[model samples]
Target: MKPLLALALLAALAAPADAQERSGIYQQGEFIDVWNHRGGHVLQMVQTREQLAATGRVVRIRGYCRSACTILTTLPNACLAPKARIGFHAPRIQGTQIIAPYVDQIMGSFYRGGVRERWFGGWNRSREMQVISAREYTRLDPQARFCPSLS
Candidate 1:
């Protein structure tokens, strides 16, 4: 029983590592091109979000952007590679028409916390941006002007 339990625990610990996807960078000319080497494109958003939040730095990731990936792009620091396959379509309505509200909802989240927009849905802006630290995030709530997370 003890040996079996130890094996189970080890497997559990190793599971996430196995599940976690990673990107590979290849030297292409003067640039280091990054590609999803493991897992699916969906993991890109989750990992990038966590990494940016923890480090509070600019992040450049490449992958197909659509569906849930759109939601993940709400992170202020997100930048989609120009060649990435980015597609946005409305959710199916009844059988034929597409729902417009889905676009609004996705864009709304982008407005709420992600990018600051002088005009909505304008591609003229660069997606590359910076994330506010925990201190800056809380400055909105005058009660907590200082966040220990900033330290």
Candidate 2:
């Protein structure tokens, strides 16, 4: 019985990371908060990609978005607050700091064509926290709409 339980545990561990539950609320074409997101597994980003694309929801980047959170920029209705900051870097395995080329390719494919070019041109993978200011981001992605302030 103990051996069977161990096998179950191992199987659970071996399951695809996307099968793991993530924390976020989905409300169709309403608001999405991709703010202050440091990012985790690439699979999580991929799993959410369809929802983001399908809903045409407004993704609000009101704070710092690092790593996979940058994927939000790919959404058709993504928007940034005036003070929002988006961070980018090569995809790396969590905890180990080991770079994953396949994950990086997945991330690279998410970026808009021009944004991809600009990002690749200026990116420094070694730095691991290159930030794009709201102003600069707007310059690079002219189609990225801005959210209106409630005040």
Candidate 3:
């Protein structure tokens, strides 16, 4: 679908801001928290994407979203804010520095094309978190378009 058409559809189907917020839906200004250090479980993130996909609601990444939260990028209905920053790092086994292949596999399954090849090229291999701004991320993955003006 055309970008504008998708945005228009979201606007039309979207519930009121307060209600949307309460229901864990994106409403431009608000964000879905996916912090890195919090290290949300990989399987849990898979479930998150499934749930959000079922809603057919637009998921916007505003402000900071890191780690497993970035998995939401796989959502077909996802969007990005101008100031968005997404962080990634090697998924480590809890309480250890060892990289978790299972976690990487799950995350890798969700991310493909440029997202898997370039963004995670070095980023996911390091324990150090790497962040890409909305501008950079858009260049890397054109599928993630910027959110439209609702007003």
Candidate 4:
């Protein structure tokens, strides 16, 4: 009986955490900050681009997502919540105000073609934060699943 109990404990320990509980707004630069502070283990997890790609779970953007958070747009299953808002701006080096073109390019590339054109097409010349309204977001990706609240 002790052996069986030990096996059960091991099984429970090995079980993956609930993905939904882990789901939340991945705010801008949060990933970068975690990576920098924790190196590889962002709380016992390796925060890698590949890891981000492998996340088949849905990402619900319910609030402002900026900078590094924009990368979440590329997740296999990404959705915008009813009141979700996204902020776009030129990338800046962590902890500094200097703009970084390479980073900006990477972020821009993650967006869908039409989204890129509409958001970056005009009126954002100064690299200031440009907000994309929930209405426009639904327009751009009509097929995208909306958060339950909106439905």
In model 1, the Cα lDDT at residue 124 comes to: 17
lDDT of 4 by residue, 1-151 (tens): 3432343345445533642332232322212111111112122222343444444434455555554565555455556666656666665555666765455455556566566675467422336767776667667756555656335
TM-score of each: 0.31, 0.71, 0.72, 0.57
* Residues 1-151 of candidate 2: C-alpha lDDT, one tens digit per residue: 3432343345545544452232232232256545466767878877665666665557666667677777777677777878777888777767776776677667777786566875567552544578888777878777776777411
Model 3 steric clash pairs: none
Model 2: weakest 10-residue lDDT segment is 19-28
Global local distance difference test of model 3: 0.65
Ranking by TM-score: 3, 2, 4, 1
Q: Which is the winner by TM-score between candidate 1 and candidate 2?
A: 2
**Candidate 1 residue-wise lDDT, 11-130, digit = tens:** 444433432242332322222222332222334535544544444433333444443334333455443453333333333333445443444343434433322232134321223222
Report RMSD for candidate 4: 10.2
- Per residue, candidate 3 scores C-alpha lDDT tens digits across 1-151 of 5443344346546634443232222333333322222336778767667866765656766666777888887688877777777888888887789998767767877775677885457766789888889788878787778878421
Worst 10-residue stretch by lDDT in candidate 1? 141-150
Location of the lowest summed lDDT over 10 successive residues in candidate 4: 32-41
- Which residue runs does candidate 1 get wrong by more than 4 Å? 1-54, 91-107, 111-151
Winner by lDDT: 3
